[model samples]
Target: MAELNINGNRRMLIGKVVSDKADKTIVVLVETLVKHPLYKKYIRRRTKFMAHDPANDCKIGDKVQIVEFRPLSRRKRWHLDKILEKAV
Candidate 1:
């Protein structure tokens, strides 16, 4: 898990915004590498998270930091904390 705990146990993650077409919402893609138990090979894993972007300040390909928060919708459990890098 690439979750960073800070500010009293809140989980934060750094990811890239893959989709920002939804109103007040953005889809972030997080990648992680895991070692295989038997082969001892690193495997890439990707996860998509639906984060709440109330300001709609994110765009596709933008690097962002999202923090875990109380569920505001059926699929939204993360809130947009900040933009780490904007897509050029």
Candidate 2:
């Protein structure tokens, strides 16, 4: 049913898979640049996201895209959308 699906924009992120030790799940590290309000210098900030990887296809250092999803576990709130690139 239409009601079963989310109807609004969802947060999507692109990051590199850092860990895949947990079955069907992955830890992705996303990095972003932010400019300091005062110093006006760009700084790198990184965040770790727990994402569902139903296929267990991701590997460390692989770039992937993920979409926000309803919480599947205590901390997993994102699901793998696609693998952008494989780690060499």
Highest-scoring model, lDDT = 1
lDDT string for model 1 (1-88, tens) is 3555577878889899999999999999998888999999999899999999999999999999999999999999999999989999
Query: Mind sharing the TM-score for model 1?
Result: 0.92
How do all models score by TM-score? 0.92, 0.90
Predictions: Cα RMSD each: 1.8, 6.5
lDDT of 2 by residue, 7-53 (tens): 37787788999899999999999888889999999888888999999
The list of candidate 1 runs beyond 4 A from truth reads 1-3
Q: Predicted candidate 2: what Cα RMSD to the true structure? A: 6.5
Q: Compare the candidates by TM-score and give the number of the best one.
A: 1
